[model samples]
Target: MKAFTDLEVWQRSRVLRNDISQLTKSFPSEEKYRLSDQIIRSSRSVGNNIAEGHGRFHYIDSSRFLITARGSLIETLDHLIVALDEKYITEEIFNKFKGDYETCLRMLNGYITYLRNQQPQKNG
Candidate 1:
């Protein structure tokens, strides 16, 4: 992959973010300031954090950001659960989104492990 955009986790997170954005529009107006806002923020944070981590000069820093991204993914899942409980979304849709987010989480975890296992460059 030539860029952060090429990373599978990043790409999937972007798609998930877009999916959540569109789904939120169907929520009641009252949710605009609550659950909808939360899911949107958390979903977008996943990709944003991943990209930020990719840009970091040190592998440790990248891993840190990846961890944060993973946290955001969890947060997004929490918001989804709330939506499901509130009857804002159907069981089928919730399951699908949750499954996709879980996949992204697994991929992000693998990426983090890879980064942590890498040896730092030695000074010349």
Candidate 2:
């Protein structure tokens, strides 16, 4: 109905970026330029892409950007899983951030579905 910034997905993504920044601080120094950096970059991409898409003039373009944002979110989650497996994070921390990631994913998917259903048909 409104712009992507006004969407719950964007808001949640902003919060997610902040949370990922904080969480990455607890990672081992060896990962400072590796997983930690990647996690932060990927997390930020989610919000950035949404904002960029919101500024686009077409719904299809916006939807495409949101899809890219969702892909980045998935990438970040994969890095989180690796951090957990490598002992960079404890189960408690993993559970907390993992929950947020899952919520973001669900919201992104819902928005994508909504966008697709709203598109008008072409006469071909």
Candidate 3:
């Protein structure tokens, strides 16, 4: 890709990050530095890591950052489940965000696979 922002996964993650920011605003004040902060940070990390990965010169280095990005995505999902259990969001809202998570995940995995293919073949 021309830039990290150009990656489909990064673009999709930006949408989710924005949505999570807005969603957390409705959370209880008590959660301002708790679950809300965690979810927001994790969501933001997804894009941050993806951008860092895209800037790497080596495919292996990029893959490592992408893996961390994927982990942050999963962490965001856990925060969503916590929100649901605490009645901070409706089941409908949870499902919507979950779908968005899956889309980013699929795209990220595909990108990782593409990068793997681009690696030089080993003589082993």
On lDDT, the candidate that comes out on top is 3
lDDT of each: 0.95, 0.91, 0.96
Q: Judged by lDDT against the true structure, how good is candidate 1?
A: 0.95
**What is the per-residue lDDT of model 1 for residues 21-93, given as tens digits with 9 covering 90 to 100?**
9999999999999999999999999999999999998889999999999999999999999999999999999
Please report the TM-score between candidate 1 and the true structure: 0.94
Q: Per-residue alpha-carbon lDDT of model 2 for 29-80, expressed as tens digits? A: 9999999999999999999998888788887998999999999999998998
RMSD of 1: 2.7
Ranking by lDDT: 3, 1, 2
lDDT (10s digit) by residue, model 3, range 14-111? 99999999999999999999999999999999999999999999999999999999999999999999999999999999999999999999988998
Clashes of each: 0, 0, 0
Residue pairs clashing in model 3 are none
Question: In candidate 1, what residue range of length 10 has the lowest lDDT sum?
Answer: 115-124
* Residue 44's lDDT in candidate 1: 96
Q: Give the range where candidate 3 is weakest over 10 consecutive residues by summed lDDT.
A: 1-10
Q: Estimate each model's TM-score.
A: 0.94, 0.92, 0.98
Best TM-score among the predictions, by candidate number: 3
